[model samples]
Target: MDTECMHINATLAKSGYDIRVFGVGHYCFNLIHATAIFCLLLSLSSAVGVIILLCKSRTGKSFMTWHKHERFLLYRCICDISYGFVHTLDHAHILITKDHVGPSGLCALYALLIVNTCLSEGLFSLTSALNAFLSVYFRKNVNFGNKDWKLLLLLGIGPFLIAVLVCSLGVLGPNGFFCAFDSVKGVIANAVMSTGMTSAILVALFTFYVLTWYRIYTETKKLKTQLSNNGCARSATLKSAKAMCLFVVVYIIQWTPLSIYGTWQLISDVPFGLFLAVVIMTNLSGVFSGTICLFNKSNKISVSNKDLGERTGHERKS
Candidate 1:
């Protein structure tokens, strides 16, 4: 193993190009690594908070009290934490070794983890949109109890299986410098995987959001009758819709450029500016998720509390 490492290092030194992890200029490198660390901290903190909430709400009654969209946010937190942790380590390894290429095993593991987390992130976004649509359109008729299990299976297990398959097939592995599924391997695996998954998620999110808001608009007249004059149901529905809308925007901002670039790279080389955009946007995902979710969660808590208090007073008067 030592001999292999030495040979790889010597070969890299012989080559004209330096082995760089971020593979960018000095200024861009500083910005990228700085953002990476910030995102790591942000993601882990939010994920820990969500885990605490999940533990506290383990009981059936308590769990059911949360807005349906919040569950998908839980999934997002998990994915962000996983992504952030692995990403931080990748950067650390590159810095400590001062070599763009990390150890083979770690590189492979990084590739696997990245693929799984990214897929889960996209899946959770889709789930959030679906939940919002159902909440608005089906109202009292929609029950996620049975269907949630299926969605959970798809979100949790499906990505793992795909990652395993890709790794085993040797289609997805470490680049000469870092781990990626991209064309760095002279294969279209990264392009195909990223494009297919992202396109599906983006399309579903758009469709769901349109249908959800449209349903909410059409149900305006019936909201009062169906909500029993308390307006709690109506308010909750709007909150869920708003959360989903924000989530979709975040998803697009963070993932779209990279997805498009990955697809484009399959056919031709990507420009340095576009590549920088992808790097910056992808790393910012955790920052976006953490900031947005924290803000929305606080709002939801206050709204729910107010709604509960109002309902209690009305019941007492009756």
Candidate 2:
């Protein structure tokens, strides 16, 4: 009876039941796993759905269309697909035991995570760059000939350089996980990367706000000019402005919390699972943004019209 009791205790210890049940680790792991899975599913569905919708739309004249910001939406969808694939790997690595995982698997997992991080940073930086470019591009006071290309280059390069530094310095620890530093080194390295990412996010948010204000100003001026001349153009201008504002607001809300949590995790000693959960949540921001874009009444109406046109064309040909 004692022998059986000892055997059970040893089994429990080895299985991590004792370690998991007594602390927050188990719950954290479960939460991370669940969130990651959800993110992966959401991203995949959103990406595929957007691709299909884009293909069916007559207004999608090219892969990088200027109409309705189709190019930006396509870029975001691609990023979402890549992010989903990386998080799937992250989820597998976290949920499965190391004993059951191979070295190749570990490397692939780490590589994917780093790549996703880089891409996320890059896309975010591009969003900021786009905002800056629009501000300069549309400004009445700013001369096109005098526009600062150097500043644009600097803005574009900043996040990428930071991403490169983070990836380069993020050493793989003895435990096979890539982190900021191995010990103290790892902590410092992580802090640097986290700080860089946080700074980039803040800059992006600022740029978005600036662009929103610029749009509002431009639209208000246009509205006034058109109204002074005639009222015929009022409805179209208002619709365009309303749509632009809606897009900006939805994006900011979806991405802001994730940025805040990421910045917090950089300075604090957060648990591994908790950190993973936060990252997963950040990835899910794409889902929310995609949902808003896909389900907006105007977008839905456009998609429906496109679908009907395609169906009519097919039936006529048949």
Candidate 3:
């Protein structure tokens, strides 16, 4: 009995001291490693995509006149790609230090995570703000002014400001092995970061979705009204409205599930694997959205026409 007690004590001591064994199973470790690798690959692919997009933009004249919403969406995609790269580094660090190495490196990793979270949330909030602006712009009676600009700026900055405040309160720091705080502090930090960021995203999404739907409804009504008076103009407006609605619907469907999972994880003590899966799935929304937007028929036509015009101009110059 004494020998058994001693062995148990030794096991407990080892468990406490070993960072890798801190309640994480082999499967969880493997998942983390896999996720890191996946994000790294995604980052590389996004980098290539970005390069291609830039080249296309430069060589294509029609690509230059992006509508305001398109510009916002493009910026959002760029931010997501940047965030993915940062996360790739964090995942790599976590995988490398499967066993607790030291607090120093872990702290740096945690800080990086915090920065990435901030940037990503900020960009998403901006996207929402721009969507709202687009809705207003599409209204036939609405006119832009200083008040509108101010309102737009406020909407863009509000969620990001909240995130910064939460970070300042120490809620958006770090978690897991890399967290610098004690158990209680780490829990609080996680709760703060998760709740604050998720709340911001939810608010942004709800606002954008509502505004977008309203715009689509109004535009459809106007198109119906104008169908008899001007068929071609009505058809063009309807087409644009349909495209916008489809884009929003696809965006919501792709993102909503991951957001639900994140909210659930924030409130509950879910398993690590589930959380990892949610993260992976959440990031995929950006990939899907980018792919659809970049390859849309209107976008492709504009790009092609711009390319042709650019080539003609270059030939004339030579």
Candidate 4:
């Protein structure tokens, strides 16, 4: 905490937030804390389950033998763990200390961690959209070779580099639930960077997934009509298409409220309902992403373990 930050907090105390409960505003103190704990536990359990599965699968085997989806899911889970860590440690400190922490390192670090994870998670969602699109349309996964440095560059380092810059602009401070851009400049930066970027990602996600499900629909109609007079739809294909839509739905539901809340935070105090909705979405994203990674398996237009291990075959270049 710098002297400047401490002075800002003193000003923020008089602005609107209670400041006693670490600027949580009028929200129920105990409720937010409880939700944060739940988020951490859910994320931990999901991560542990995936780790055990991965470790067991790797026993007496090479890592490269894995299906590409496995690696993607594991990396996404890493982001999940990042979110869980931020909520558990940072939120707890704020509640426990009752706004007494400091001009300190904790809020600064919390801002950095949360922004990095949140942005990375958005990009990861885009990765998933691309994965689904290519799996159906091209029927192959690109193997980046060695350390997956390309993906590491995109998912691992990219958002964090931007996060470092955002923090450097000196907009970090207490928001309603967590410490992030509280100053006017910080709010505008978050509006353009966080909310705006997420909105763009959402549009791209919707476009890709729609094309995928449409491919399934149109091709299924053509092939199936020739085999039967009834021209019956395949139930499994319908189910898979429905399941594909679920991921997009989850991402939209998770981020939209929070994005709206971020923009609203710029003008005036957000209502309790909107505040809680945003909190629930941001924290629970870990649980949602982990669940999708675990249960989402090979499908009709996608590859299974048997196909994944094969060297090559499909309409795809990869």
Most accurate candidate by TM-score: 4
lDDT scores in order:
0.63, 0.46, 0.47, 0.63
Task: Write candidate 3's Cα lDDT for 245-283 as tens digits.
Answer: 444454455445445654675575555545566556555
List candidate 1 stretches off by more than 4 Å.
1-31, 49-64, 138-148, 182-186, 221-235, 264-269, 301-318
Query: Which of candidates 3 and 4 reaches a greater TM-score?
Result: 4
lDDT of 4 at 68: 53
Which has the higher lDDT value, candidate number 1 or candidate number 2? 1
lDDT, candidate 2, 118-157, per-residue tens: 4453454445345433433442111212233443344345
Going through the candidates in the order shown, the clash numbers are: 0, 5, 0, 2
| True-structure Cα RMSD, model 2 | 10.4
Cα-based lDDT at residue 106, candidate 4: 68
Which residues of candidate 2, in runs, are more than 4 Å off? 1-25, 64-68, 98-129, 132-137, 140-166, 170-185, 214-218, 221-251, 262-280, 295-318
Which structure is stronger by lDDT: 1 or 3?
A: 1
Q: Per-residue lDDT for 214 in model 4?
A: 91
- lDDT comparing candidate 2 with the true structure: 0.46
Which tens-of-lDDT digit does each residue in 59-85 have in candidate 1? 565543454445656667778778878
Global local distance difference test of model 4: 0.63
Q: Under the 3 Å rule for N, CA and C atoms, how many clashes does model 2 have?
A: 5
Tens digits of per-residue lDDT for model 4 on 1-318?
A: 112122234453432133444334434765766777777778767776776676686688666555555666677678778778776877777777656335646677787888888788787677666755665567554444566777778876898998888888777666645666653346577678767887788778879877988976786767664644222223333333444455666687788887787667667766757766766776776577566655564342343322422333231242
